[model samples]
Target: NKVSGSNAYVKSCRRDGVTRWSDGNTVSGCDGGEAFVCNSQMPWAINDQLAYGFAAASIPGLTEQQRCCACYKLDFTSGPVVGKSIIVQVVNSGPDVNPNQFDLQIPGGGVGIRNACSSQWNAPSDGWGQRYGGVSSRQDCYSLPAAIRDGCLFRFDWFKGADNPTMVYSKVTCPAELVARTECSRSD
Candidate 1:
């Protein structure tokens, strides 16, 4: 077991008063932005070994500016949305929505309306029912929303049953593969 300060920076990252991610303030960026190494005896610390990644996506028609960065810690798929489908960027407001209800905001100050009727993950009486088994829809929904309104979000491809949209993602990556067919297309 080793102590900290072995090339470690002491810092924290927070959004809307809740910490999202963090590191020491002395640097511009992380050399490997995924997992960090604390002392082996550090309680509740994440493991160090990983294959990290960072990416961003912008929904053009929806006018959202989300500079998303994700780390592929354990062979997790990289996609338009690293954690959820309706990724969007808004001005100022973040993580402090009333009712503690999660909401997605588009660039034009438009609030995303969840198609509760059509949304695959939500049910009025789901003590155990879920598309991907979570308190919310993040664990479900294989499609990433580019445009959302009128009881439906414009997601080009959606997979049924499986948590990951491998087929759809593969199809979407096809064009990009043409740019470098011999290599794996980096998902962003």
Candidate 2:
């Protein structure tokens, strides 16, 4: 969806807080009222180990089932966030979010940790080692990470405004060793 870099911001998901959804239930897309470790685990946590991810209000045309485990690669183009990019997954839905806007996890979103999210995997300061913003900017959208063809791991591709985006997103899947403990389903 070619999210103008200016439109993206940073947000973290935690297993705590009354208003927050459990990581176990969040990712399962519980259409049948069944939770699948969606809110119980963090994207970075392996059976309580720390992990990372981001959130969004709504994607272009994906159903709730399609949103879970969805990934997007954000490349910042301006401000203190220039020349940096990180991959994030869809862990929570933000009804209040504007179109083309994203709420990135503090760790992977480049935002310094602030104890706002779960600290299962690592310290708050360990968040993506940086932070972006809540302002409007420009960023290029791609389904696959840079230099995908040069790697051995499976690659998943996506567009900024794709229709009915799938769960097989590039960044959503936890590595094989980590998946047994976390909720992120394996795409491969």
Candidate 3:
């Protein structure tokens, strides 16, 4: 299935061991009480023109269970990353996500509605930057844990610091690399 729109933006979620519906267990480095965003959910560049990443999406008509682990090929139509494509696997979802939004899970990207980074990584209450848009520069990536710093840098480098680029998206097969990270596959 495919959907085209101008409302999409690659919002960032904070990194921590969060209990996501797709993966029932908490990722390492956080107490078991709350599930934070997994560090492995971070996005990475496959090449200058392409990338592979994970996102927590809200697609109208699909429940979280239906969306989890599903892959989408996003062809950017605007902003610095216009024309570049990224294949992202849906690993998380939330009620706050507006319809058609894919919140890319970048480490230094803002924590959105959650703040487990303070408990898991000792980050500030609002995370590395503004609560909604995260770290302003590549240098801020250094503040993230080593395991996820590369993903933060990816936003500044491969992603070209594009602020919420709009994209045309379609459902696609999940890549093995992404499946290996989330250990999830949609039954549908």
**Winning candidate number (TM-score):** 3
Q: In candidate 2, residue 143 scores what lDDT?
A: 18
Pick by lDDT: which candidate is best? 3
Q: Rate the local accuracy (lDDT) of all candidates.
A: 0.22, 0.34, 0.76
Runs in model 3 deviating more than 4 A are 1-34
* Reference-based TM-score of each model: 0.16, 0.38, 0.82
- Residue 36's lDDT in candidate 3: 56
Cα-based lDDT at residue 128, candidate 3 = 92
- List the candidates ranked by lDDT, beginning with the highest: 3, 2, 1
The C-alpha RMSD of each candidate to the native structure, in angstroms, is 18.5, 14.6, 6.9
Residue-pair clashes, model 2: 40
Stretches of candidate 2 exceeding 4 Å from the true structure: 1-52, 107-181, 186-188
Clashes per model (N, Cα, C within 3 A): 2, 40, 4
> Arrange candidates by TM-score, highest first: which order?
3, 2, 1
lDDT (tens digit, per residue) of candidate 1 on 87-169: 11111122233321222221111222212212222223322223223222323222222222111111212211123322111
Candidate 1 — which residues are off by over 4 angstroms?
A: 1-68, 71-162, 165-188
lDDT of 2 by residue, 42-82 (tens): 22322221223345536667654555555665554544334
lDDT of 1: 0.22
